[model samples]
Target: MLPDFRVRQRDYLLEIARLLTEELDLEKLLARILKIAIEMLAGQAGLIALKETEGWRVATAHNIPPAFLSYLTPLLAEEKVADLDVTELNRMLKELTYTASMGLLNGTGIALAAHGQVIGVIFIFRNYADLFSANDKALLGSFAGQAAVAVHNARLYGQVNIEKQRLDALLDSAADGILILNADLTIERVNDAFERIFGRTHDQLAGTPHAEVIRWARDPIGVPLEEAITDGWPLTPNATLY
Candidate 1:
């Protein structure tokens, strides 16, 4: 039969795989990974630090009391991990361990990397010395890889959301009465200009058929603009006040 330690190790590996696949939000994923790390390795606390445009920020933490969090906030503010060389990283780790007031904490840290770029760091902390084994280090490293992918995905999602908002603002600012139509010629979006020109509210006009909208706006010449629109022609060459 396999050794009990080997069986436990397999279980831990399986759990890690499940955590990586199941969690999509980076913050929640990091929290779940840290909780697992603490439980599997007998660590007291864990912290995840991510690289931002400004500096390194704590993305997640587990089992750390509010008091410790308060103390750590200022120390981590605008902390640029990207600027640190290996020597600097080592020195910082040593200093943190030495100055930590909670207890004699033995900690392991691994950098989160993707596409050959370091994105963040994962740290596992314990109250006793020599708590981290070679196996623990290897496992944490693998977990970091998964964390990097999740963080990258989160950043990309955030960027996409920002761009969408910008595009929406641009559309709203357009002076012309712009209407977005689907394949069925149903209205999707009507801007402020549309509301003013058509004398209709967004709530009243949205989702209405394009043909119906054109019928509603009968021109001074009694021409149905819907016919021109459906024929792919301009309604008027010059601006008409009405």
Candidate 2:
């Protein structure tokens, strides 16, 4: 039978996996990751630092003093957490905490990576000197794998949202009427000008067949709107059919 703590660990890992898949908001996801890591390790504090083009920066932290974060920033540049000298790190932490009037701290961290690319690092600190167990490292390694993927996904989602907003703004500001269509010629998006010219709102026209919404009168050449669109009929950018 599995030990009680082992069962709890399994459950937490499963829960974190669910969060990783469902949560797209970066801040909330990082907060939860740090919270779970600290709880699992019984740490006094923790932080997750992400590697950026400029360098490493703290993405989120729990119970860690803001002033001390800058001191930790340079430490994240190390390729792996295992490269850190624990005794020397602890000594430095002790001196820093003493000067800041905080508790003596010791910590363990793991590099967060996905697809063999290191993205970030997570560090959990305790007030005691007891070294982290092999089990602790193993659990953290498993958890960090999922966390790295989640963080990367959340960042990509954010970038996509930003680009979508920019596109929406550009579309709404256009002088000409615009209709975005699906492969089946259903209206997917209608710009503000299109809505105004047609006397219909986007909500009303969206998902409706363009043929049903816009009754296109044939030009002098008796060309239909569908054919004109398919054949690039206008012949010039500013040319109007009627």
| Tens digits of per-residue lDDT for model 1, 89-204 | 54575567647744477677888787788877777778877756787777666666766776677667678888988877898899988887765778878888989999998889
Task: List the candidate 1 regions with Cα displacement exceeding 4 Å.
Answer: 1-24, 65-68, 78-82, 85-87, 173-175, 180-242
Worst 10 residues of 1 by lDDT: 233-242
Residue pairs whose backbone atoms clash in candidate 1: none
Q: Write the residue-wise lDDT of candidate 2 on 87-121 in tens digits.
A: 44435445665566454666778877877777777
Please tell me which predicted candidate would have the highest lDDT against the true structure.
2
lDDT of 2 at 132: 86
**TM of each candidate vs. truth:** 0.67, 0.78
